[model samples]
Target: MTSTAASPPILQFTDVSLGYGDFTVLKDITLNVARGQVVALMGGSGSGKTTLLRAATGQILAQKGTITAFGQDISALSAKQLQAMRQRMGVLFQQGALFTDLNVFENVAFPLREHTKMSEIEMTKVVLDKLDAVGLRAAAHLRISEISGGMARRVALARSIVLEPELILYDEPFAGLDPISLGITAQLIRDLTNRLNCASIIITHDVPESFKIADHVYIVGQGKLITDGSPDQLSDSTDPYVQQFLHGKPDGPIAFNYPVTPAFEQWLQQRKS
Candidate 1:
């Protein structure tokens, strides 16, 4: 389905609370990814950015509220229906989780083979086109072990987009990358979003890079949204926590202490007993 500027969002989450079992990692989450928009989820580690991605993919049901993707409410979908919906979405995992048993070409070709009955010639052309988009067509025959970290990330990106999905979810895409590779990957993501005219949700902690490419940004902390706005708005925020995070300050609203009994008090109590 093609989307225009006025079309409804391709993805939406409304008051969603997500986590496993008894603990909630993200609460009252409301976000959307419109066609041709790049939305970045910014937070520190354990702030539940990746959990939101998982909820969007229907890998985990929200503890409360609803998640809608491709115009369908995810919680209402049966297993088969959810699986079908997921076929239209692509995901680039945090670690570039490529298939070790497959070479670069085969890794990118896997989705095409699994989802479509394209002929061998057609599949080869499509796979090469995707790999070429990520600047890795020359290394098509190389083993996963033979590629550098940056190259492997490119291959993962290629694999994710080979099917030409309408939505792409990137989880920690810039994690562990050097400055040069990080910048290159960020540009590649922005270019792909524009070229394909698809919506994207990026889960990341890199503030400057996220602000650089994002059409909208949502900052989360302690399982709640801290602020949401355009890059400029966020940059100009006066919220103490937002200011600290944006400037990479050592101290601010966030506390470093773990929620545990005070050590000196515990020792005194034990001695008295």
Candidate 2:
């Protein structure tokens, strides 16, 4: 008999443990993302945000529990099945990761040409369409290195969405971005998720930026989810760790415990005195 779970989540992690061999960074983590929602995974440094991001895409092998993406066990998939699963998701790396050697058009078209047996003319049309959607069509012929950081991210976004994925994972998409770029990227995320009716997961510490786009938020501390809620609830939360991190305080729970080197301490003291 098939084990039936009523109304299973679109993405579910049941007591899932993750990390490298014999070392678990995230332990007994449980969460579910409903369809058409954006979830932000917030945390400080070393909070296992990257690990969870990789787990979502099946890039990191789960040491325990089950990861169900689109209603199937991600661990049970064969190579072909995994490839098929990955195709349904779009991932934007923190660095944008566009190929420096390739021009923007080629970079965007790479996934389509690799995954599908489309003709060159068909591939070109698809690439152009996606680039235009991200407002980078005019720079299609420019080399990756030629574009600014914001343009590079737009190109990366164009490439990720070329296949029209149902899930998009952004691993710190806002880092190193100028205010204008950060605003654009945030809007792009909101627009694309709404337009495609796909779920989005962003790992970031920029609370305000995440608040602008996230329908739901999850906070990870010391490799565990300390809390999960809507932006308003999180903003009003009095949890010490949550309060400290969210308000960017200097003497709160996280800051008091953060390691300070002797050199930096001496420097700070000298400046104050």
Candidate 3:
């Protein structure tokens, strides 16, 4: 693992809070991602992991504190400036989000075509190179619908890296894969981050896989950062929440049922009446 202690971080969040209108989902969050690092953001469903991604991408502004990406305050960037900054980043969404009508090669080439003025020949070479990196070069001509789910995901990975982004955000990269494909994807994520010398933040619940590739890990719950450290450090944690989450215990700091509201109780009373 590379030490980022001597270098400035590529992305930083200082006491950040994020959410939709009138509701803050995560609060007082602080974290940083440095070049040549892969940080895993782990949490249960509805724990605001994706909300952090939205704030990072400028899809939504932080409700409080600051978010600095590539040394720029994303909240303060002008529309044109934000667009330019976004071009330096790439996102692999949970479902791959490929264009169903486009073939694998074209899917991977979409970002290059949209952002650069390269000729068709140049675009083809770039797309094929990225596809080859993901071990899907031969499937370049296959339609999106004709490939397996894992292949489609690889195509999405190729697309995300075709531009060679400085920051890569992966949202549930291993959500729906068999053991073999899952392991392959995890290793690929680590290899690509090292090869690109870029910063990566993976938001996933797959503890074992994420830990294998992650240099750092942050666990979120109950609207705050529960804890953060290296995978080994987290594994040694005695914090009840951490133990429960890491070991998949049925009961602990995390509850199996959602909290009930006063209105819900009143409604139940009225129904009984």
Top TM-score hit: 3
C-alpha lDDT values of all predictions: 0.89, 0.85, 0.92
Model 3 clash tally, residue pairs: 0
Residue-by-residue lDDT tens digits, candidate 2, 64-172: 9999999989999998998889989999999888889999999999998788999999898889988888888899999987888889988999888888888888989
Ranking by lDDT: 3, 1, 2
In terms of lDDT, which candidate is strongest? 3
Extract clashing residue pairs from model 2: none
Off by over 4 Å in 3: 259-273
Better of 1 and 3 by lDDT: 3
lDDT of 3 at 73: 97
Superior candidate under TM-score, 1 versus 3: 3
TM-score of each: 0.92, 0.88, 0.95
Cα lDDT tens digits, model 1, 47-111, are 77888888889999989998999889999999999989999999999998899999999999999
* RMSD per model, one decimal: 4.2, 6.9, 2.5
lDDT of 1 at 248: 83
Which 10-residue window of candidate 3 scores lowest in summed lDDT? 255-264
